[model samples]
Target: MLEEELVELRFRLGDGSDMGPIRYSSALTIAMLKERIVSEWPKDTKITPKGSTDLKLISSGKILENSQTIAQCRTPFSDLPGGLGSGGAGGGVITMHVVVQPSLTKTKTEKKVDDMPKKVTVCSCTIS
Candidate 1:
């Protein structure tokens, strides 16, 4: 089955250099996703977002990195004017959407066997 997802992002830089908003993607599992999120955060701080979207309409909430929660968000984009405009100034808002597509192909060890016999006999049990 095909798997797709949408994620909310919070581009926060305490330094206030105005890096602007960013949309990121990944295929890591929820466990890995949580790990990555915390690991990527400054000093591994887990963000407890209070609002789903920021003052700039950017998202700042909990999101599933392995599901379809992202479809609810619009795609074309409504980029904020501030911090990204000419001369890019101070502190920007949080409002960005990221799409993550994960591949689900089976590994070699899990591949289907086409040459296996319809029935097989083991020492004490019969296999089919």
Candidate 2:
């Protein structure tokens, strides 16, 4: 594929910071993109994704599915301001929002609570 045909993408975190202005093939799948994101994730961030499953890629106000390709997720140039009649490497770079949602698993402290002994109450009744 020609270099001009490649899609340029930038990943934006919740903090409004950017990851890359990297070029990828239009045929690249969202799942593949997630893998790349997990590997290239910034180490400085307090919250990091454990795996690709923890990532959600949102583009153009829509959540991109794992099966979707770069071309399918790309926003039309007309929809962007100052993006008319542009294509290829020099064209506007699409920005995708990356959300890291960790799995809801019980922590060690929670497990310890379950292991604790239950309180016992003894009631005594006296009848005359």
Candidate 3:
């Protein structure tokens, strides 16, 4: 797990909506966050969940790929409706979602395979 913490950025909707952005206080690592959300999202699927608090990650217009690398962290409300790269929000002052990316100081180790050869022995040879 990374040492960084993730927080959601909230924003208000349009059409006289009073709801702010729903963000998550990420107490998890970046890999865990991606794993939790990615597994539930289908390919080229847009999913919307009830309530602004819960983000379905994939929306109807969002395109997701298996080969794509998951960014450890995302800006607040980055996945919210009209949050990022959308003109619907009209470029207003939106709160930020702060997510912690995984640290790069971890070391990986590999185990070596045994070099012993297999031996076969038979007490007596049987002729069939």
Instruction: Specify the highest-TM-score model's number.
Output: 2
CA shift of 48, model 2, Å: 0.2
Better of 1 and 3 by lDDT: 1
Flag regions of model 2 displaced more than 4 Å: 1-4, 78-86, 104-128
lDDT of 2: 0.81
TM-score of each: 0.24, 0.72, 0.21
lDDT of 1 by residue, 28-91 (tens): 3443333444345344333332222211223344443343323333222335444322111232
Count clashes in each candidate, considering only residues at least 3 apart in sequence or on different chains.
3, 0, 8
Between prediction 1 and prediction 2, which has the larger lDDT? Answer: 2
Q: What Cα-based lDDT does every candidate model obtain?
A: 0.35, 0.81, 0.34
Best lDDT among the predictions, by candidate number = 2
**In model 2, what is the error at residue 108, expressed in angstroms?**
14
